[model samples]
Target: MPVQTRVVYQVNPSMVNALKTIREQAYNASRGVINQRVRIQTVDGQIYEGVVVNVDRRHVYLTVPAMQGYGRQWDEDLILTLVLYELLVITLLYI
Candidate 1:
C-alpha cells in the first residue's frame, strides 16, 4: 500500500468578509424584532414560534411558552437558542 498525503486549503478572505456581512445583517434584522412575537423556520424544516428575547453574533434567543401539566411545581417559559446561520425564515406573528 502507498502512503497517503493530506492537503489543507485556506479559506478566501473575500468569502470570509461576505459571510461576516451576512451575519451582521442577520443580527441587525433580528434585533429589530426584539420583544415581538415571531415564527422562525430552520433550514431543516423545523419551525418555532416564540417571542424574540435576545440575539448574539451566532445565535438568536427566543422565549416559547411551555406546556403545562408535567407535574412541575414552578411555571416557566422555554428558551430556545437557535443558530443564526441555520435560520431560513423569520415571520412576525400578529396574534
Candidate 2:
C-alpha cells in the first residue's frame, strides 16, 4: 500500500481576506455565474443551489424554484441574493 501525506499552510487573516477580495472582483467582472447553474456554500455552512439570474460587484442573485406543497415551481419575483464575502465555495453545475 502507498502512504498518503497531507500538508496544510496557515495563512494570515489579512492575506486570506485580500485573496478572497481579489477573487471576488475577478469573478464579478467575468460574470461567470450568469446563466450558469451554481451551488454555493456559505461561511455559515448554508447551501444555496440554483441558476444565476443576475450578479453584481457585491452580491449574486439566483433564480430558485419556490416549493409549493410537494412540488417545486418557478416564481419570477423570487430571488436569492448572496453576499460575496459569505461565499465559501461556489461550484458551477453543468447539465
Candidate 3:
C-alpha cells in the first residue's frame, strides 16, 4: 500500500511582518466565512480546502477533509493548522 502524506507548517507566533497580510485576511474571512469553505496554500507545498473552523493569533485551523477515505473524526494530526507566517496564500470563496 502507498503511504499517505500531508504537508504541515510550523512557525513562531511573532511572525508579524511575514504574516501581516494573511492575519488581516484571516480576521476578515473569519467573520464572513465562520466555518465556511477555504483554500490555503503554504510554503511547504500543501494545498488544502476545508472549513475554517477556528483562527487564532498565529494559527488557522482547517477541518481536515476525508480525501483518503478517513472518517469524519479528526484527531490533532488530521487538522491542518497552518502557521500564519508560512502560508503563501489563503483564498476563501464564500468570504
Candidate 4:
C-alpha cells in the first residue's frame, strides 16, 4: 500500500490582486444601489427583492418585506445577508 501526501500550493500575487479588484468592483456596484428597491438573484437560484441597506467587502445586506400570516402583524422587516460573490444578477425596481 502506498501513502499519498497532500500538496499545498501558494497563491500567486497577481492572482490575489485580480481577486481584490473583482471584490472592489462588486462592492462598489452593490453600494450604488443602496436605499433603492432592487431584486437580487443568487447563483443558487434564490431570488430576493428588497432595498439595499448596506454592503461590505463580502456581503450585501437587504431589508426585505416580512411575510404576513396567521392574523399576526409583522412589524419588523426581514433583513437578508447575502454573499457578494454568490450574487448573479441585481435588478432595480422602478417605483
State which candidate, 1 or 4, has the greater lDDT. 4
Writing each residue's lDDT as its tens digit, candidate 4 over 1-95 gives 99998869877877888767766777888999999999999889999999999999899999988777668767889899998877878999999
Backbone clashes per model, in order? 0, 0, 0, 0
lDDT of each: 0.88, 0.75, 0.71, 0.88
- Largest lDDT belongs to which candidate? 4
**Model 1 clashes, total count:** 0
Write one digit per residue (lDDT tens) for candidate 1, span 1-95: 99998769878877988777777877888999999999999889999999999999998999988765548643689899988877878999997
lDDT of 2 at 12: 85
TM-score, structure 4 vs. true:
0.70
Order by TM-score, highest first: 1, 4, 2, 3
Supply the global lDDT for candidate 2. Answer: 0.75
TM-score computed on alpha carbons, candidate 3: 0.55
- Candidate 2 structure quality by residue, lDDT tens digits, 1-95: 99998768777877987877765774574287688888888889999788888877778888776655446555554689888777778889889
- The better candidate by TM-score, 1 or 4, is 1
Identify the runs in model 4 with alpha carbons over 4 angstroms from their true place. 1-22, 68-75
- Model 1 C-alpha lDDT versus the unseen true structure: 0.88
Write down the TM-score for model 2: 0.62
Higher-scoring candidate on TM-score, 1 or 3: 1
For residues 1-95, write the lDDT of model 3, one tens digit per residue: 99998769756768755568767665565546557787888889988888888877777788865555445554343567777666666777664
lDDT for model 4: 0.88
By the TM-score metric, which is better: model 2 or model 3? 2
